[model samples]
Target chain A: MTDTITISVDAMGGDNAPRAVIHGASLALRERKNTRFIFHGRQEQIAPLLDEFPELRPASTVRHCETVIAMDEKPSQALRKGKGTSSMWMAIQAVKDGEADVAISGGNTGALMAMATFCLRPMKGISRPGIAAIWPTLRSDIIVLDMGATIGADAKQLVDYAILGSALARCLFDDDAPTVGLLNVGTEEVKGLDYIKEAGRVLTEASGSGFTYHGFVEGDDIGKGTVDVVVTEGFVGNIALKTAEGTARQVGSYLRSALKSNLMSRIGALFATSALNALRRKMDPRTVNGGVFMGLNGIVIKSHGGTDEIGYKSALSLSYEMARSRLIDKIGDTMQRFPIKVASEAPEAEPEANSA
Target chain B: MTDTITISVDAMGGDNAPRAVIHGASLALRERKNTRFIFHGRQEQIAPLLDEFPELRPASTVRHCETVIAMDEKPSQALRKGKGTSSMWMAIQAVKDGEADVAISGGNTGALMAMATFCLRPMKGISRPGIAAIWPTLRSDIIVLDMGATIGADAKQLVDYAILGSALARCLFDDDAPTVGLLNVGTEEVKGLDYIKEAGRVLTEASGSGFTYHGFVEGDDIGKGTVDVVVTEGFVGNIALKTAEGTARQVGSYLRSALKSNLMSRIGALFATSALNALRRKMDPRTVNGGVFMGLNGIVIKSHGGTDEIGYKSALSLSYEMARSRLIDKIGDTMQRFPIKVASEAPEAEPEANSA
Candidate 1:
């Protein structure tokens, strides 16, 4: 018998709102019979959606919230105004109160991260929480962290991310000792900023401490699956992620036009429809929708605000898997077993800048 | 009558050296009638390759150099050992001595940049030179600069890149007022590091200073053609460029497998061969081979060392276009017209780190 996993959902978050959230929970509940949901949003909006899913209604409970955080609201402003009442806040609050195992939101990333950090607080020995995104690669899925959870990171923080990311990799991939690589401008040992080199040195010293450290990897290595976890400051990591997404979209557009250029090609498209659909399924962003917030006291998975029901269901599934794997305990255990010792000459940590 | 544009070639630089260099020059000369070449490498190797093109033999002169910089050599090591006698050094030296209108090298990038900076020197008021790459977008080609010529950039240096990149944009795209954008994790003004925000403030203040400032653009905007020129530090810029390249390759691989999965798909691929070929041509990396060294006194174009003759020709063509357009003078004029004024409170410049 499996343990029942309860997920707190920000029902009024995301573009599709109550309908997509309720339907997504229904889909997720259908697959995992032991799963339950506590939806936090306005009762008027969510009641009708709940009625439409009779099966989900029995396994779910609604906690009405007065306000919702706007998608474009600044992190600080959202934190100030929506501290206790907003659906986004209440969803995360459920996790803090031990009412739910995980909190999932499709609200603005900055707001979601800010709320998660404030409500759950950072884990012991962790200064800031990093968002670890699962990237699809040619070989296998790789974990990339500091995906815009914070603007910058220092050598110690980078090591923290390494431990956090490797823990997540172990949880998701069932790998006992994941290979980690420091993201740099080049693979050469002497390239990139001082902080990166310092991080590389520390990671080198800490090799076989829960994870094996590959010296350095360039941005291209993310897609090549050069390592199980690619660690970097949030700024570069975020840019690389978005850039890859943009490039994939650009190539898809080119492919679409190529297949529709002429009558013969259109006929070819007809014959290759099934194959192309299979390819589409392989490349679909919905399958990989969750960005797990690492270093937080409790688990919080952020789903893309613009994603549909299918994407939301994927996020819920990720939350379920993470909850069952004891991710937080693993992270704490890794940090305790292999505490990072910063070199005396390592550069001082820079002040954090506000990020959205 | 057109003025004879002389280009210095590092014949022993690339993987298929002397042969590809001489052949690429021959191909470039056929298109641009008023072109001449000064090849710098081993006379024993270049002489035989030159014999194959009778017309090119008369239009080219060979300068012998004994030492060749290895691709894996560090920038500082290459600079110390191959300063005067190396083929790469002599090629840039030709441009400095007015023996050539432009210098072209398919050598190791770090060695080429180091040699170019040492021989030709940086333009006045410029701290370090940047490498501006022509990125293909859906609407048109856009210029992105500081493609790993240096590691980190200050606010002033970023503004300098804006001016430099726009000048390159004007020269290549024939745009009088090219729009420029600072690459950030998010388009929001409050997002990213302090230096990026400071750069944004300065650019906003200097809006009509030769180029129109489009504020901040995320990584996705590069392919969307949201701005005519994207300015960033080399660290992020290099990563974004390589990540995009990797994603395109990944997608292409998926497409290939999809079109060859079964007999029906294989037959479909046969019918769509012409259309697919057209798409392949559009996506070819060779078409955009050059990375122009900006903020330098003389023009230097770096080609991919691993590229073949056709790719080398594209770099040569880019050099010719830049030389003819008076790119250096344009950069100087832009600086003179609208000098960047960084705020007093802006962060101090970080020390340069060695990159390869």
Candidate 2:
């Protein structure tokens, strides 16, 4: 018998929790047959939901957790108060203890990150963990990382992100070596911050080691799929991700209004139902719900807190794919090939003062 | 007789300059009866293009320039080589010399800003000039500032951007007290850098003095048009702008492919031509081509370097409206009413070190 991948689910996390979490697990199980789940939350609440899906009962085991981290709780507070007893902490603990292959949560991002870092700790040679999002591009899906995990990063950290993001693309795309790019305002050599520029130099040197560095790419290049992996500091990466999401929703609104403006368009929309459905599927955010936390010892995926069952299922699917690929090992191997130097040892090759 | 708005044109700037510049000026003259242009470029290039538009010849005069700034020229190189002789510099000087009400360019962003700041100088009580882009939103259009004019900004600079952006909204939207917001990673009080947080405090105190402060707004709020002016540091703002553009293009590409996958959808696309055209018009980058350079002594509008005649015409139209509105005086008055304190005078109320 094939060894089943165990997934730890934070049942009390997110807005539509317990039900969404259980239902999502059921849906994921339908697609990924060789899987087992341990739901961490109030066992009584999870039991009733699991009863609704009788088939999922055999594959899932409910673990009682008394505390629920608030959706808006501070990261420091979450870490201090809900260290081991909270549902989120317990789910992450499962992965840390090697009881589960990966953990999935749709909780407050800051708290989730803080707790995950505390439980799993950073991988060797990795100072901090970053979140990598799989973005749907024109050519195909691309991986973009450091999506608001931490704000500004030094050149060494950015280089680490390149390795982390490349590892993610390797797993998702099933390619051993993925083309990587540093996201900047312009593709010109003189553009962006010093750290980005320095990281570019480092990535260039590490091209043949595992990943292929495509040099600097602009914001537009991300959607154009100019590279398989796009690396950026968390602040710009977060803004870019949110801006793209907002723009997609904005365009969808425009399309809806345009199709409903007149009878001719209404009839046209009816005829183009298949086409519009395809378009909707391409634009659907739920299909890419999970953001994998990289540079950590264990795997953790963060789903959108407000997502429903369908979105949660997508996140679980991501978790399963990552576990199957042994993404952590791939990242670890990649890091070993190109060991990152600490910031203290870095040469003071600072860029010009007016560069910014 | 009404005082004609004399516009300075960088006729040799963009990819399709001289012709586009002349044609756009003619288009502007059609809409605004009281406007004249002093086209700065090689006279030989301008004279022939001017002959193509006979009506424009009567209202336009070509100023011979020995140098033209290359579209890809570095700011430092342009400043050193082109100096006062380049078409871009001459146009900006026209505004400085009060020979033209405003200057418009379809040239390099860095070169334009470098020259404009050098020629026009920063406005009174302002540390740096920020580029303000008018973004189309679900509600209507909102102004986002510091779109790569400079990189990271201090609290005082951010507050200046708010005032500058507010003054712009007042001119364009005709609202005396436009609502303003500081762009951040999250809307929470503790999120983002201390500069943004401190700016929030300052703006809160200055509310109703000139503009209505809406506090912090996240990236999604930009598309939702949650406020009239969205203020941010250039680095994040530029990334947001470009990311939004890329996403729009990506979605458009997806729509085209989806609509052409089969015959039924092709027929549907044909039937929905008018509706699609409306949507296209709304999403057209040309319609919002102008990026107004604010916190400067004189007005300068930057058109997209790769834009067409229609787009150039839009930039010219913006220059006309801004000239007519006496935008510079309004900004001056706003600045005088709310003089920002220098950083030296700021209280030592720094945020915690771990905030970033």
Candidate 3:
């Protein structure tokens, strides 16, 4: 018999709390029979949902908590008020205390990141943590990182992200030598900032030693699957991710409007229902809803706060796969074995007196 | 009666060269009867094509040129080799010498920007030039800028883009106080780099003084029409633009595959041909093919190099509108009227000793 992978879930987190979390866990259990859950919230709220899934009853347990992090709470506020007794914190603490292999929360991103960092801490030799998403592309899925975990990154931080992302890709894709690319404005050698250029040089020198570094990639290259990992500072990465999502939604809306423009088109749409259903499945955002927080000592998957049960189940599945792969240990090993040279910061662009 | 808006066209610039360029100009003339064209390329190549349209013969003039800038030539290389005699250079020089009201080219982007900067120079009190695009949205079209003109910008340069973009918006959208936003990873006050925050503060201070500053906007806001203009550094801006394009194209491909998946869907598609045609029009990249180079003293619209007659005509139409609006002078007047404080450069993130 295989070992049961235990997941700590923050049941009081998300828009549709307790119910969606319990439902998602039950769904996950249905797909993976050797899975166990530790739901953290009010026992009274979660116990009734568990009763509905008798098959999941033997594999699940609940931990009572006094407080829950609010959806819009600032990171600073959440850290101060919701640190110890909150379900979000307790869920992360379960991973820290070795009670669970991974923690999954559909909470505010800022609060979750703050809690995860405070509880699990950054890995050895790493200064900051990054959030990564599995981006769906035309060719295949690629890993994109720093999806708003932090704003800016220095050259060393960028190289660190490359290592972290490469390691994650290795665990998820089972490809040891995943091709990595730094997202930049252009693919040319002399295109970006001093930090990006320096990181490119560092990756070039260390290429064959560990990961295969495929120089620079522009924005379009991400959807084209130009590399296995696309690394950038959080600000650009987050914008790119959201922009792609928004574009897909906008186009979907346009298609809907066009398909209903005339009487003949309305009949055509009815006949093409199955084909349209297949198209909707191909474009479903729920299939890729989880964002994995990397560069930490433990695994934490942050589900979208407003996602449905299907989305939450997808997140849980990703967390199980990551825990099974021992992603944190793999990242630690890769980073420790292969070191990169950080770019020397250039002297400040000299302060010009206010030219008004 | 419209004082004949003379346009200098680089007939040798694009992939289809004189053929597509001449056809596009004929199309433009049909829409705006008072428009006149000064074509720069081999007279033998353009004269025959112009002969196809009898009415265009009187309103068009062709200037013979010995050199043509190649599609793949680097900006720096093009600037060096094709300085004066090349068709692209001569087209811009027409605006510089008052021989034409505006210049339009379907040449390489970098080469076009380099030539425009060299020939037209930036307006007074502006350090760098930015490229602005009119993006179609669900609510209305919005203007997004710094679409890969230069790499990065300080707080001051970003504000300048705000001014330039707003001025263009005022001319095109006729909104006296266009809402402007600085693109960031998040809409919160405490996210993104120090420069973006500083720009936000500066713009906030100057809000009622000129354009309406709408604070920070995230990536999805661009398509949602959250602001009249979205200003960002070139790297992020370029990526957002290209990512949206790639996503739209990717979704289009998916829809095509879905419609052909079954015989019933095939029949459905045939019945919905007109509606599908309308949908195609809405998503056509050709309708938004031009990228306007702002902060320059002259109007220069860069059309996609691979565009056909339809796309080139769109670029020409934009040039006509900008020329009629006198966009260059409007931007200059706005900048000169409301000048804001430029940021004092901060010390660069210190170079850490190589930790490899």
Candidate 4:
């Protein structure tokens, strides 16, 4: 039974708190059947939430970690200072102790990222961890990475991101080695900055590698899904994520207004119920609540802090999928094949001079 | 009739130029009665296109300025080599000779900006001229500056961007002293880097000016039009523009697929024709084709390079409106009214940075 897929939940973390986390765990266990569950937080704090579920009370599989790192504190500082915090200690201990296959959180992003990087560590040959999220766009699915994970990046770093993304795509979708693209201001080779031009050269030169480098892709490409992986600096990635979310919400509202603008449209909406529901399901953030922390030795997920029980359940399901796929081992193998250190060793992390 | 609202046409500009530019001019002239058009380029090259539009040929409105600049050359180089080039010399000569109100382009952005800056010069009190684009978002209209004009900006520049944006919004929209917002990673007071944080303070405090500085706005806020004017670095502004465009295309396509999935849905779409048309109109980029290059001493509008007749029409409509609105005059007034200097004081006659 223990050999089956198992995930540890930071039961005391996130806005939904003890109940949503515990409920998610029970759902994962009941739904997956061969999964074991543990709630990481003080037993006293997590008990009431688990009690609400009732069925999992007799299950001895529930493990308790008695602390929680607050969502608002500095992640790195919280990791060191909040050592006794159940969420932090439990996540690290679970992976170290081999009690759980993966740890998931909807708590402090900085703290989770800090703990994950410091405790679990980056995979061998991996420069830094990247948080990869699948954006549902018009043409196809696009994987956007370094979304608030790696802060400032150079050309080589972005290339490495592309390689990691390709490997992840291969593992995630079993596609015939994905197409990689660097997000830039324009498609022309002369367009963008020195960093982008340099990255483009490296990517183009190494096109014989497993991933297909598709030169330059603009912001609009995220939704076009022309490439499997859209690589960009962390700052840009974060903006892209938020922008897409904002756009989805806006379009959703706009559609609502249009439909309600007239009586005939209202009647049409009633007839198009199934179609609208399908559209909503595809765009629904709750259906894909978890964002995976790739390039790390262990799998970590960042769920939306404002997620409800249904969203939490989706995150749990995503966690199970990651564990079953052995995403970490795959990323490790991929990074080992192509590392970030080969090119940047000469400059030794020198800062760029601002031309503007 | 020709003197009131004159605009110089870069007849040789854009990918499929001569024909497109000439056709657009004729269409604009035919549509807008008060405006006069000047076709500036080699007389030999301009005569044929003028001949094609006989209605425009007899008006003696097309002025001959013989020279043309390649789209890919450096801006400074374009200016230096622009003696015989129709696009450059004409655009420059028109503004300098008072032959046109604004020399609009579908040519090289850097060259247009460079020539405009060197010849007409920056408006007094304006140290750095940033391009402001009126972005249509989910919320209200957003005056986003430095869309690409001045990339790689620091905190001080961003503060100025916010200032310019707010002033533009107030004057243009009569927005009650429009709310100024610094675009950053988070809404929290201390969310982004020192640059962003510093900018945030300037916005909040109004930097000794009575600016209604709204708090920091997230990427999501742009569409909601939450703030009247949103300011950020040029790179960020570019990202926002593309991301918004890409997301809309993606979601719009997705809905189309969903709508066509079943027979009932197709029927539903037929009934919801008005609603769908309304959405289609909102999503069309053609409706908002003309992106103004604000902060320049003279108003220059960039029509899309790939634009068709409709796109040109949109550009003409926007240009005519902007001309009537006195955008340049308002910008100049704002620059003069502001407590800060528009351009750096006491020009050092320092060597230009991009001399090469």
Best by lDDT: 1
TM-score, model 2, chain B versus true chain B: 0.94
lDDT of 4 by residue, A118-201 (tens): 667666555666788877766556688878775567776787688778777776677756888898777242323678778878
Residue-wise lDDT of candidate 3 within A1-356, one digit each (tens)? 13789999999989988888888888888999899999999998989998987787999989999898998887777887888899999999999999999999998888898889888888877767889999988888899998978677777777888899998998888898999999887735244477888888888887864479998888888888889999998888999999988888899999999899999998889888999999999899988879999988899999998988898899999999999998987888778767565542432211111110
Which regions of candidate 4 are displaced past 4 Å? A1-3, A51-60, A187-192, A343-356, B1-3, B15-32, B41-60, B65-84, B124-128, B187-192, B207-210, B340-356
Cα error of candidate 3 at position A227, Å: 2.0
Summarize candidate 2's per-residue lDDT along B1-356 as a digit string, tens digits: 13899999999889998788788788878988789999999998889887888888778878999899998887777877777899999999999998999999999888888889888888877787899999999998999998988766889989989989999999999999999999888835243377888898889988886799998888888888999999998988988999999999999888888889889998888888899999999999998889999988899999998888899999999998888888888898888888446472332212111111
What TM-score fits each model?
0.96, 0.95, 0.93, 0.89
Q: Rank the candidates by TM-score, best first.
A: 1, 2, 3, 4
In angstroms, how far off is A353's CA in candidate 2? 34
User: Chain B, TM-score, each prediction?
Assistant: 0.95, 0.94, 0.94, 0.85
Clashing pairs in 1: none
Per-residue lDDT, model 1, residue B332, is 90
**CAPRI band for model 2:** medium
DockQ of 1: 0.68
Best to worst by lDDT, what's the order?
1, 2, 3, 4
CAPRI docking class of candidate 4: medium
lDDT: worst 10-residue window of model 3 chain B: B347-356
TM-score of 2: 0.95
